[model samples]
Target: MEQNRCEKSTLLLSVVIGVALHGSYSTLFNPLTGPWSIFPLISLVLAVYCLYQRYLNQPMTDGMPKLIFSFFLLGLFGYNAYLKTSNPEMGSNFFSSVCIVIIAYGFIVKLNSVNVYVNRKKTLRKHRKQSNINCYQLLVVNTARF
Candidate 1:
């Protein structure tokens, strides 16, 4: 059950980042000046929440500074995308930005997945450690009796 919770949180992290980065880029390359800022801001907020949860719930994964910084890239991507669809003023530059955003999003998702998997694996290691301690005590007791 705990593992499931961790996995779910990790996936949610990806979704929020994906949306936020797209939104952020829209603000940059897009001449429309529409809702591009919302993506990065929203993504940052979610990232903050994750950090808060990290401190409050697990307290183990204390290395998310990179994740926090990545939000900026996400915002850039979102703003670029927004410009492409809204204002044709940016021209082909917007399209190229769009490609950049897509590639960035993919890499972000992959990185996030690896971090989550490591977190869960760490949990398993603790459980294994406890079992090993118990087995060693049992073995010593049997040998003493013999």
Candidate 2:
């Protein structure tokens, strides 16, 4: 069914986001220490939760998970930009972080759009079913009058 396909696509998107988060963490924060280490861990946990939700056929309609990841990536991009400004040697990191941020933003937009589509489809189906039931009831009433 279309719903199943939507669920699968959402799951795939979540997996991609997870992989991207891991890549960003590895590339940008290798040997990360202090309180900064928690950011990636938080992202990882959110990704896992999102995946689990999708697996359960309860994909979040609010797009909160992707939004959170996008915000995290934006913060990372800002930090990298600041570091690059202070030390030109960090240019590569800054560039990579920028790329990651852009990619994450794109994915987030896509994921949210997909979620909206699924939701609309679900609502349409519900309305169709309701209308069918109403039609059936009307038919039954007319038949009874005979």
Candidate 3:
């Protein structure tokens, strides 16, 4: 159960990071725009919630962050691909940005998974030790009765 919770939290972290980065890029690339500003604001709220959950050592509630971010990325990619097809000059930038985002996303997921897995293993070891201690106590009591 704890392991499951940890995995969920880790997944949330990955989503938050991904969204936040995208939001940052949107704001940087297009300043003073109302729609682009919304992404960063939403990202900020989610980031705060993520930090609070981390501080409390609790799992984040499963939410729509991943779905929204995925859709945003897909839209961006489709738009870029369309642009590249129409104007070959932008093909290199489109591919490079896509490659960078993919690599970063992979790294974040892998790092979070390792951290969560390690914590889960440590908790499992602690639980096993506790069970072993109880068993030993039971054996001692039975031997004493005999």
The lowest-lDDT stretch of 10 consecutive residues in candidate 3 is: 59-68
Using lDDT, rank the candidates from best to worst. 2, 1, 3
Candidate 2 local Cα displacement, residue 41, angstroms:
25
Spell out the clash pairs found in candidate 2: none
Q: After superposition, how far is residue 122 of candidate 1 from its true place, in Å?
A: 5.4
- All predictions: root-mean-square deviation over Cα? 7.3, 8.9, 8.7
Clashes of 3: 0
- Whole-structure CA lDDT of model 1: 0.62
lDDT of 1 by residue, 1-146 (tens): 88557645654565566555555555666546655455577666777578567657763344354544454455455555555556666565556576666758866886798889989999989989998998999999999999
Q: List the residue pairs that clash in candidate 3.
A: none
* TM-score against native, each model: 0.41, 0.41, 0.37
Q: Which regions of candidate 1 are displaced past 4 Å? A: 1-62, 93-141
lDDT of 3 by residue, 41-87 (tens): 67757765775676477544444345335544544454445445555
- lDDT of the candidates, in the order given: 0.62, 0.63, 0.60
Candidate 2, residues 30-57: lDDT per residue as tens digits? 4432234455556667766766666587
